[model samples]
Target chain A: MALEGELAAMMAAAQRGDAAAYRALLKACLPVVAGIARAQGVRGEAVDDVVQDTLMTVHAARASYDPARPFLPWLGAITRRRAIDRLRRAGRRPVEVHDPLAFEAEADPGPAPGAHLETRERGAALARAVAALPEGQRQAVEHLGLRELSLEETAALTGRTKGALKVNLHRAIKALRASLTREGE
Target chain B: MAARHEQLVEDLAGRLAPVRPLPRPGLRAAAWLGAALLLGAVLAMRFAAVGMEGQAPADFQLAMVGALLTAIAAAYAAFVTSVPGRPVGWALLPLPPAALWLGASGLGCLRAWVSPIPDLHGEHEAVGCLGFLVCVSIPLSLLIVAMLRRACPLRPNLTAALAGLAVAAAAATLLAPFHPHDTALVDIFTHAVVVAGVIGVNVLAGGRLLTRG
Candidate 1:
């Protein structure tokens, strides 16, 4: 209820052309939009660009928004589309890497009680590895590993054929695994 | 130097602001003019046809026409809102006229449905329903086309066309009255499906054209 009231107030302010309200709304929503874009494998300088573009689209189209509806779905749709647009512009190729650690992360259910520390440590290690990847490679990993784009979609967006994207993605995964394993040891 | 974090946040916020102003010159005028022309044509055709029939003027016809035109305008306003870079000003502009249309139509339909007048013939009723479907479908399809044109980067036309078909099918299902007659059922299905297919084809072709480099 509080969230709804805040959103309604924010929307009302936005309608009144309140720049502060618009800025507040954008700032509050930024992390979620950024996460969605990152999950779609967008990386580096392009991440900010995609987010900005999505925000612009959202702002320009604000009047069309029905205050009666939930905001997340609309935001998600814009983020997803913008991410796809960035991928298309970049023409990055996909890579196919069989990283046991990454696959394990997906396959494992919730961490066991005693394993919580280990899980946290591993997650931290993975985050550092992701942060450390070469800009291009990091993007490929994020797109394939996090966003779960099909090889075809990844290729189409990046202008790389399936084989090329696979190669790049493999290299990215190998690097991430090596970094994590080193941290583990 | 201590305010660096705040500065960064402010900078990011500024960059993310919507850079494009609402487009004002030609496009807005075109949209409004187009809407006006459409409403005028619909009204003219209805009145002209009714006069030619040389039968007792059914009060219901005016209501039906009024309701349809209002719905069309409302739907169009919705489209304008949905379009990227469109001003908020356009949003409210279309509503008053639409509300008037809806009010007139609603009253007419209600009166007709409740009146002690003899039941309309099966054929006439079917024709009326079909007319309603077409009136609703065409504008809605156009609205979808307009939206797609704005949203799709690769092939606006094709996207618009496909979007139009989808909109038509969905609108028909929700808005058209269901009847038991085989002919009515067939007509409904046929109209819905055909509109969908036509719009899809138009969008695909438009996309190809737009993207051809």
Candidate 2:
């Protein structure tokens, strides 16, 4: 494609330390990198983080590029790698679940008027949401989120490795957040 | 977010300086191979002076050829894999030659088993051979890893492992020309252990060096 050729030319020039060409190339790469993150299932503000991380990686690795080869695949690989890294970091962190698995009792009554009804409706919606998840995701949410089991315990109970459980938990959280956001809207 | 992205682009462009791209993977690999061969030749000469006097068996010759090929293939693979977006499958290029080396060496062991002869060398000589392998591998591994660091490898551990394999194969091949003992159980075991240690160290340390933070 003409666009790929143009980008490759820009990159070749950028490799020679042409500042304007480098700037143009990076600015052009932003949308492509962001789109790649979305295609790889990175969503929301995290896509922006992936785009930034990928640009940095591209800068660091520019010397490795072969001008004789097409540039898009090289860029795509770096973007995907950065996107996976973001997903892995996100997976490793604790995810919040909507259901009330723990309680910290306050001396004062919680809320007034229809607040209890609203809370009950939200909890019911969350329960339905969890039920609708695929088996692995649902189990991950239950063992890792609702029950608050350690990763080791969850793996032991579910017969999944810790890595698999983490991936499932990450996917479940993403699905729930999307579903809940749509419902809220 | 847009402002931050713009600022980042500007900063990166501003910091940019004239850069020389790395040579093609094959060319870089050849350079590494040249250095290895030169060192191997020197070591072979030195080893011949004090080593046992006997014609090497056909199996030993086959093992040496396999080791040489392994060194070339693995060195090329390491360079290829060091570049971002290259096929990771390049990492497996050395496997065939590596298998041949192992198999040929194993045959030597089997042959010895069938025709129980006196041991080729005493325990101290075996230990000396081990020391030779480890010492020779150190500089070779360092040199290859240094070359690899020029390119940013997404899979640093894999690239480093390949470099370790290349260096170990080259050093082991060098030992063949003047090895004081015939290939047997102890020699095979020693080489295997040394090779594994070299690869392990590279994966742990060289991987860190290749990572661009």
Candidate 3:
């Protein structure tokens, strides 16, 4: 409560032309915002971006501050929004509740490089096999496997349900594996 | 990191132009009440009072008072919310007044229901009453929004919504006296729509727009 009260007072002073207090508040808020973003499951490059965006948002929305309210709820709301926006931008919006039941079926990638000519032939064979699939399967492979979009984002872009996208992706992977195995044999 | 801090500090200095704490709620409440009264007087001069044109409802004055109180309380709440870190509960300041105003509108609707008057749907005078309310609210809202923007509300939409609600309700107060044609329910429904519109617009976009602070 003291920290909360302290931040609120600093925020008020910062509102009142106290530049030093403003800087202190921003600095103090950085780690907190970053932690919040991380807790939302943001990782690596996206983490810093979300934190930066939250900071910028906080700076911009300072006028709407209410002295009667706890400061964290306001900050928390902004932080969560910036994190979601980041996730949305990355095309990684999670579709399901993220249980263990989900399967991420990647397109059969070419085997690890052996002889250079063999690698080239196998890569070409894999590409041809992918191209031969139905358009829906091909699109699913490209979006979910090649571009690494989540099921939700792929569904959104393709105007299909998550279930449909998952089915298409799974089928594409199965077809690719069979085609590659037959060619190898 | 140090460089970022320095830059942020510099930005804060640049942004800190004129820091004005919101006026006390009582002061803001009184100011809106006075402004409503003054505007009502002027409107009365231009167009005769509703009583002059027809036998005004018995609760017209009471409804006007309720609207004024709504204006006052909401204006105070808006001001309080604009200052970041204030308790969220302070936004509740307008609830009682808003309820009072709504209750008064209910009575007016009840009266309209029993009497020969059109209930809510047929009140064509609503158009003019709404117009008058907007006319009064626009300036009041601008002033409050200006105040809110200076404070740099953390929740820009919430602050803007309250500011809009306050001024619009303030305008409704003045319109209540001059508007004899609007049934109570019409005032409530129309005013609610306008206020919600204000809130929605601010939430969607105004929050981004009001960040000058």
**DockQ of the two-chain complex in candidate 1:** 0.03
Cα misplacement distance, residue A136 of candidate 1 (Å): 60
The sequence of per-residue lDDT tens digits that candidate 3 reaches over residues B45-97 is 98776534566665666666777777777777776666544566878887887
State the lDDT of candidate 2 residue by residue for B1-111, as single tens digits.
999899999999999986787899999999998988788788767665455467767887788889989999999999999887788899989999999998998988888
Predictions in order: lDDT: 0.55, 0.88, 0.71
Q: After superposition, how far is residue B144 of candidate 3 from its true place, in Å?
A: 3.1
What are the DockQ scores of the candidates, in order? Answer: 0.03, 0.47, 0.15
Pull out the clashing pairs in model 2: none
| Candidate 2 C-alpha error for residue B207, in Å | 1.4
- What is the C-alpha lDDT profile of model 1 across B74-114, one tens digit per residue? 44443443443344354454346434533544554555556
Give TM-score values for chain A, per-prediction: 0.45, 0.55, 0.50
Cα deviation of B10 in candidate 1 (Å)?
Answer: 6.5
Using TM-score, give the best candidate's number: 2
- In the range A66-147, model 2's lDDT, one tens digit per residue, is 8888999889888888898899999888665432453334334657889989999999999999999999999999998998
* Better by TM-score, candidate 3 or 2: 2
Which parts of model 3 are misplaced by more than 4 Å?
A1-25, A36-43, A57-105, A108-185, B1-38, B52-62, B87-100, B117-130, B181-208, B211-213
The candidates, ranked best first by DockQ, are 2, 3, 1
